[model samples]
Target chain A: MKPVYRFDGFIFASLIAGLILTIMPLPDAINAWRPAWPAMLVLYWTLHKPERFGLLGAWLVGIAMDTLTGTLLGQHALALMVIAFINLKLHLRIRVFPKGQQALAILMLVLVYEFLLFWVDGVAGFATSGIARWLPVLSSAALWLPVAALLKGAMVLARRA
Target chain B: MAGLKPTDVLPGRGPALGTRLFLLLACSILLMVLDSREDYLQYIHSKLNIVVYPIQAAVDLPFALADWASTSLASRRQLLAENRDLRRQQLRSDASVQKMIAIEAENARLRALMDTAALMTDRTMVTEIMAIDLNPYRRLLTINKGSSAGAYRGQALVDAFGIVGQISDLGPLSSQVLLISDPEHAVPVEINRNGLRTIAVGTGDAQILNLPFLPNNADIRLGDLLVTSGLGGVFPAGYPVAEVNQIEVNPSQPFAHVEAAPAAELDKVRELLLIWPGDVQDQ
Candidate 1:
């Protein structure tokens, strides 16, 4: 958990919304275009306000994702928590970066999450990585732009209020 | 991306970096073992699914809404046409029922064929599909019937047309069905007309199945209907499974690649039945 001290109902609502969008019916070709929206948003909150949504929150939400999508149990839970933990550790440095560089960092974090997924899946005797499976990471990279912008805007609005 | 920074700060950097990292790594490793070596995690899957059901139900809400909205203005002409169509379908089904009754009567008369030894029939649970897996490579569908409906792993699920697939996972109130067209699934079938047995494997398309290893110039043809042979005993005998669409014989390959279409319409299925054999002896 970070050093933030607020309930932030709006942020939690946005995270739920992101999870809803994650489960929506995306076309097969663009299905991989479905990014790690929930994870990215979770990371943004964990970094910007680490105290509220911490590693435990990430782990629970990840389990919910795996269950909702019927993936192998603990798959997304493990990946999400790892990424969230990393972000928490680098909370100060991540906030200092400019928008463009921050996006790059988010991309790298998502990349690590994807790699962990591939490795964990392989370890369990599941089939090796397929080329199409990586399409989400590319989509996740592109998705960072809007997600970051939304969080940035939300924080601004909160401050003004 | 310019905005005010987060101000509601709480001191969360309690655990050192190394400690959290070690805990995370340890937790993941434990999870991996539980997921792999231990099959009992099915209970965990079921409980978690119950927790996330609202999310799934929410995701499915739009489709349900769309379906509801689509039929609002269904015209009288369409209803009449559908009634006529359903009437004709009912008539066609009645004929099959008559044929089944006749077969039952004949079998009763020929009691010597198989003993009338108290074969208890297993009950069937009707299930509706909640959602289909759009993953082209992995053919899976979430069904409404689950452990609550007495659906178990490896139970056979069939439709009005023929065998669709079997239950792969038994969730709390929902289970995952692996369609016959999935790459990982295979069904034992026989040519209904000739009784030549062969294993039909999923070709990753609901419309196509691959029948491998019939000798060159074997007597299989286009439009030949294949039915379950009951050899593997997983499925009941004499259910339409597929129709041979194309058969290729390559002299150099030493094996004929025969392709067929599954009789069960995976794309259009709304309701399914989880059935077990009546005769436990045969099963």
Candidate 2:
């Protein structure tokens, strides 16, 4: 007899880990450079398994992130749902591209995510903290290759079991 | 790939992406508007926070363990030295407190004779900061004390040096504080030098506070101490707020460019005193 690895369980674990990483504290100098973990996870899952993780899942995760980060409710929800939507539309074309090209797409997606956030903050009259807010986009882009590879490896192992 | 079914290899499609996107976007927009316009969602947010608290605790576990290790494994000599230093600092603080007590008594008597209101006997609860806001645009902190500890919105948070911030959101087991250094926050303060009243606004920089709308000829100068004016009733009177570090006055300009260093260690302080004002008296 062999054990079966559930896709739902695998996705759940990765999302939870993503949530933790999204809120983990970092030093002041590099905190802004921390990758957008939940966004990246949403991109990967939406790209790989669009049926399992969609805009709704991204919205829920974003709301939880809002609560965790203590920001205005729905701010991240709006941004992440948009990200998920874009990823869903482009997932087919994106999945076939090489890792480097995929990372470029991820960069554009993350930039769109951050831009939505910045617009909301502006309308709310919140002061922008220099240009450090955009650092996460670059970091998230740099992180996509490894994150996608890890998720791919995990899915393969889970399916084999 | 040989063993897997065609369905297993292909991505399963979900609901119409466009429709789902539109619906979620509308719902999210509604939520963001409600959250910003009213305090109606506070309880819901607080309840949702409970679901996420465990994750936050898990993230903080490593730091907590290291802190515990350091405290538990310190050498006897180091402990003794720390104790000696604390004792000496306490003695010096005691001397200043003794003088404060006499001055407060005199102030009370004078107020009574003049038929003015007396100061409330403020009670304070010590709380440790649990988390800090990473978004540099917003200055906020979550503290361990909450509604369970009698924490309420608008309660003043202070440190040994001076006032730090105010409790903005209260939860069951935790509360969020808006630091005084937040760009959106402003505190009414009086110059200790000439009793000049002004509003000190945060400049988005940790060390600088902007004193806006001051007359170019206002008797403010560099190195003046600013204390809470208690005008808005948000903060009590007489706590140190900031020290004037730079003052630029131009004859052509209607206002002076005044910047001050916040008296409280806003960036570094870990412990805060949650002040609960005891009573309200009519002046």
Candidate 3:
């Protein structure tokens, strides 16, 4: 199947939609349930087509997140780029994995991203970054099924076309 | 003839390696510099919000519908009960206000006799809480009132109970009110029962506020009620701010680490009043 149709306009638009979700005003109680939509969407696309979308796209999307969420600048950008780079490196082997294992890989990638964030902020002495910040990784994993299905649907549509 | 063989070049290398990394590093450094020291990002913070606002509104759709459903489903009996309760409470408040007016008159007379400072009545505006600010660590809420509606920066937001925080960020349609419980926010307060003054700062944890610099032997009791001292010219005096919850003293340290709970129901605040004194001669 041609990679051109799946990873171009639709991918960029999807990333923006994910950013919209990231900025959506959820109350404190429910915010923990909000998945890391942008990270998941970007990583999925990067794994699908590393040739068209790569580290730069992920980094830029992350920087947009940083600006939108008003967090430590470049933190998400750096994390996203690393996620993309590693996923791209594993795309060949990862593509053959069972659905469950693939989901596990995504979880590991998200955990790595969270670890980087923890290391960076912990050293900076801004206390109370809190246990809550890392909760999104678990939430993102729980959200993986719908995301994988959506991406698979898009890929199937492109193949039929 | 001038071209080098392909093997000489690194496989992963893209053009202008140093320049790209330099630009990336430089841009982020510039961003950090602007965000922290220069405050240049505030303009971007203000304007880009317009682009993001539509998406935010769309995101709030489910919440709005939920609120609508709950209100619409309220039984007529419940509505009547609520109305009756409100009316009874209003009457009780009116009677108390009448008594307060008489007492205030007596107070003015006594103050005139003694040549003492008189109490000032603050002008206030009612503003609806639109939504909480997206930053989880920062305790800020957006109020429906804005510059067009006569809201401005540095104005304190309060409820019937006591002070919440001041309007720190202003937009055209709404203003961002940072809560007094934010780590960066500090309110000058006095213990009304004993007249002990201290500054209560937000501790970044939503549940606790810190009162720094109270002497280890400061005449503070465990349950002392704290009120705004009116030292900053922002908040009015005699409004409840917090109740002293815990105090820890180290024998080596001169000051005690005093913690108190916030006066307002911050997590549950749906509506608040913007307290602006009408006799703001400075403005």
Candidate lDDT (C-alpha), each: 0.77, 0.85, 0.74
Q: How much native contact recovery, as a fraction, does model 2 achieve?
A: 0.68
Candidate 2 segments exceeding 4 Å error: A1-5, A155-161, B1-15, B279-283
> Largest TM-score belongs to which candidate?
2
Cα lDDT tens digits for candidate 3, B1-283: 1353443232245634344445554665566555654455656655654555555456556777888997899999998999999999999999999999899899989998999877767777787766565545667766667677777778988877778889876655666778998776899999988888889999876668898889888988778888999898888777888888998988799899889887877777778988776444342
Model 1 per-residue lDDT tens digits across residues A33-53: 678877887788888767677
Model 1 spans > 4 angstroms off: A1-8, A152-161, B1-13, B71-73, B107-125, B134-136, B212-219, B231-233, B251-255, B279-283
Q: Each prediction's Cα RMSD?
A: 5.0, 4.0, 5.8
Tens digit of lDDT per residue, candidate 1, span B1-283? 1242444234435566467767866776676677776476887778876876776677778877888876877898998999999999999999998997687677766775667543344557688777766344667888887887767788888888889998877787888888898877889889998998889998676788999867887788889999988777677677899988898888898879899988888778778989877734332
- DockQ result, candidate 2: 0.55
Could you tell me which residue pairs clash in candidate 2?
none
lDDT of predicted model 2: 0.85
User: Which TM-score does chain B of candidate 1 obtain?
Assistant: 0.81
lDDT tens digits, residues B124-212, model 2?
Answer: 87998778887878888888888888888888988988889898877878788998888889999999988999999987678988999
In Å, residue B49's CA in model 1 sits off its true spot by 1.5
Clashing residue pairs in candidate 1, if any? Answer: A2-A50, A2-A51, A3-B9, A3-B10, A4-B8, A4-B9, A4-B10, A5-B8
